[model samples]
Target: MFSATILSVLGSVALVAGHFTITYPEMRGDSFATGASQYIYPCANVNQTAETNRTEWPLTGGSIALDLGHAWTYAFINVGLGTDYPVTNYSLTNDRPLNITGKGDLCMEKLDLPAGLTVTDGQNATIQVVTVGETGTALYNCADIIFKTSATVLSSDDCPSNSNITTATVEEVSTNETSSTNSTADATTTTTTSGAVGTTSSLATAGFVGVAAVVIGWLL
Candidate 1:
């Protein structure tokens, strides 16, 4: 009963707050509304349109930068080829698990695209950023990209947590693997895994259920 009460309070707080921004490639649109709808799946209901800005990325993968807004967040990065991408069409590019404060600017200079997830020159694709914060909510944001063989690739290093590869992570720091939100210039960080911070299905696969289980265990 007490656990239920705590869960209710946390849910309410999370619903009202918690959002992030994609700075580099830029988000499709601002779906950062103050309701559950803003946290919808596959780009948060922020449809792709003629006016939706698209950036050019390399067929060998590219860089992405974001402004995180949570203290502790589980971040995940994904990619879906072509247009009107469905959830299943997206493949996990990177994932990191743990408790870490996520705030400020985080730039992934170069990324190594996952296998079986290749694109041709001038192919349209979308990069999905999923982040789950301390509230166990999955937040979503997406950036449109047009693959180009000419786009510069900075780093193709594999991610520390998973096989997903990325060059380096910066502007965030943590004593352990988890990063701090308010970052410093000199603070070195690991390869920060991207995440979607507000979704039911996303949370289930994102290890957020483990967070809930921990909370429930502590309360009971």
Candidate 2:
């Protein structure tokens, strides 16, 4: 019975674990193609050797959007400056972590570059979006960009933000062999209300990072 229950829960998760794509600033490559895995470190299965279609991002800050696959995710934004190596150093864009509620076309109009992280005109960089859900694997996608002094982010019909969403920090707990439960990140919790009028809740345990998403009355 226990094994059957695991299979049933995992079966539902299979539909939601399709990964995500960067919409605003073009994606590096098609990470959702057949036989592609977004969990492959820095930039998924994108061919980093070849130059991608670089979007003109403002020097100060610009818009960033994601076409998400999961119902909701504990998402993180990191920026990698320069093309020095295939795996560049990625710095978190925000001090407070962001959790995006709902699965489609979520946009942030002015996502600034990391504070004190300087850049000049025509400098190359990459915007990395890492999403984690019930599966516990950190899926990643990136958008290649060129910093410009006069660049601007124009919103499109496709980049609409979701209403009735939860955008806050969902605390991540790290578990060790000795201790099974240890909370981190100031114990900040976020609540999300999604789906139709009479919504059903769900619990998503990202076991790898030990983070459990509580979407209010979530069924285990």
Candidate 3:
């Protein structure tokens, strides 16, 4: 009867596991149909001091997978403190240190960049990822930005560039209209100011970096 009892317990455990999986289905990382996928994670502080490249609990999730298309960044900025720790470099290796230092209060969130495009210098770039909701919404940490680069997107043949690449319409297009650079400077200035404002909360609430929370329904 001992063996029978053990089997019964094992069956119950399996049932529970199944229920959990069904309740919380895994989240799929971003994907690209043409080429490789890319993810960017940016974090900055008021001091603007660049945090070390860390893969610890709060910065990066454990384990990662990628092809040539994967990329990641950790950017910090604080206009008041005059600290702009812009992310200079990153890699998707098994063992690499990602840096993040404590401040008034540690703020954590995932940045969702464009589908396949990533910006190294987010501050200078026009468009970037802003937090839509609470922390831990994204799946991976700073360590491993997952993606698979597609050859088509990477190929120059399909994405030929002319002198007026930005405005010129490709033959693949049927018709088009032209527009001006209207509001370029104003938009840029606004973004810069807004970026600074976003850090106010983080710097004001200086706190220790908490242990990275295990993402529920994470994609491998």
Candidate 4:
């Protein structure tokens, strides 16, 4: 019974830390609301005309929230702008997990705009999240933004302050793996992968499960 209880506790901890999703700028269409299994690009069944707006853009120094599906070792956010879909103009890369407090918490990282990066009013922009590792997957969310001058820029106070947040130190992952990007009859696909990160914890958890089973058998 004791072993089983321990196993249950560990499993619950793991589940709590895993599971992330984008919750800002409302993410394109209704598919995200239902957690549908659709690719995250081209506004996800949204019409181009309906996806563009002039008043909803994040300011140059604002932040966005990423409700994590699971704890990740590294994450990056990229921004693209164009009249067409899948704009690829600017990117902000972070080597750390962008944790606001600790591992497995919601990541509310600031979007640091690149120097001189500007977007016109009523422009279409896409924010993409690329997580690294076996659980790694690319998620794309787009928003309509108006780039105001620095003097009149609007910043988001919605992002939680990281003042008392202490982030975990994780080893760096490799960047050699290539993500698959294919254009086919069904739809366009883009895959992004980062090296194996956080796999050790998974393996250790598996080991704990095995040990717990053994202990339970002995007690029985």
Candidate 5:
């Protein structure tokens, strides 16, 4: 009975450490995929349907949430405003800790546009998260957004470079055993896994890091 209990606990922990997804502002629909395989640009996805389109929200302020499957040590969140498909033109706005313990439901963060910046009432934007580890592997998630604005639509050329936006980078925590962290920033959130030597090894060796990156790229 004791052995069975131990196995069950381990199994539960393993399952919890295998996935992460955006839960707020509604993510692009991709039920068949999980983890990093669930996104392509903002609203584009293999399993996307017309219903998958996210509802338009006010561009000024809102909250973003993440559903963590495993613990991570660091997270970086970026928000981009664009008229293009891939929406590569963006700025980093948030960097913080995510899921430091490896088990949690939803981590929420606030988001706000920079002062003096203007967004048209109908402009399209995207929120992306990049969770990294010392192992050099990362997980990503992107969500589409339509800002409530009355300003005229601007072309890609009209959009300015990310250089104008102020960015903040949080220092990574130092440790010996492998661990993860989770953080929520203004309108964005990032979750990353890091640690000394013990717990993080399981995450690095899970062989899902490379696969997750490929899946994200493939979907794009």
Candidate 6:
């Protein structure tokens, strides 16, 4: 009787423990931006139409420079003609990322400006710069003619600045793995214990019935 009682109590405890320990490991996701800006230009694509295209002034210092490390997910580029554009979408379509922060002299930030667009007289254009993650891309609009004047491209080896790649990481607790393993073991043990208890209870009931039958035969 005592043994049976102990087995029943152990099985119940095991089942309860396994249920509680199953929810151990989890993951969390988050995102943040250090700095961001919103600007728009009404510059139409010079190649798209013969009408006067939009124009912008050059940075007073002759270059647009930006710190790449300041952003993590999405950079927006507005042509003033269209809605904002993500840097990645623009960069992938072309060879290099666009530079809204014009770093090069006559350097059109958007490397893949239509061939028809030209920068003349070193006129400067404004760019709406958006940056994504550490490894994201940008697309700048480079129209050859801004406001009927031809735009020129100034070539420079180290023009627009580049910064280190931004990074995002997700981490779990150090003991997460161990706790997960322990939970699995506990679940397995609980199942085994419950099965064994069921078998023992059935055997005990059968033995009692058989003894009762033998005792009746002796009395007869």
Best candidate, TM-score: 2
In order of appearance, the predictions have TM-scores of: 0.60, 0.67, 0.15, 0.48, 0.50, 0.24
Model 2 per-residue lDDT tens digits across residues 4-108: 999998975764456778887888778866655687766776766565688999998788877778776767777778864334455454433456667676777
Backbone atom clashes (below 3 Å) for every candidate: 20, 0, 33, 8, 33, 27
lDDT of 6 by residue, 127-171 (tens): 333332222222222332222133333334533223232211111
Q: What 10-residue stretch in candidate 1 is worst by lDDT?
A: 158-167
> Which has the better lDDT: candidate 1, or candidate 5?
1
Local distance difference test, each candidate: 0.60, 0.65, 0.21, 0.43, 0.48, 0.26
Score candidate 6 by TM-score against the native.
Answer: 0.24
lDDT of 5 at 122: 78
- Angstrom error of the Cα, residue 19, model 3: value is 26
Q: lDDT winner among the candidates?
A: 2
Q: In candidate 4, which residue pairs clash?
A: 18-69, 18-70, 19-68, 19-69, 19-70, 20-68, 20-69, 57-145
Q: Which stretches of candidate 3 lie over 4 Å from their true place?
A: 1-135, 139-192, 196-220
lDDT of 5 by residue, 8-36 (tens): 99986664466456666667654335532
What lDDT tens digits, residue by residue, belong to model 1 across residues 95-189? Answer: 33334444555566665787667679998888887776666667778889888888874443421112222222222233334366654332333
Ranking by TM-score: 2, 1, 5, 4, 6, 3
- Candidate 1 displacement at residue 138 in angstroms: 0.8
- lDDT digits (tens) for residues 131-198 of candidate 3: 11123233121121222231011122322222211110001112233467433211001011111112
Better of 2 and 6 by TM-score: 2
Q: With candidate 4 superimposed using the best TM-score fit, by how many Å does residue 184's alpha carbon deviate from the native?
A: 44
Instruction: Give the lowest summed-lDDT range of ten residues in model 6.
Output: 21-30
Lowest summed lDDT over 10 consecutive residues: which window, candidate 4? Answer: 188-197
Query: For model 2, what is the error of residue 122's alpha carbon versus the real structure, in angstroms, after optimal superposition?
Result: 0.5
- Kindly indicate the candidate among 3 and 5 with the higher lDDT: 5
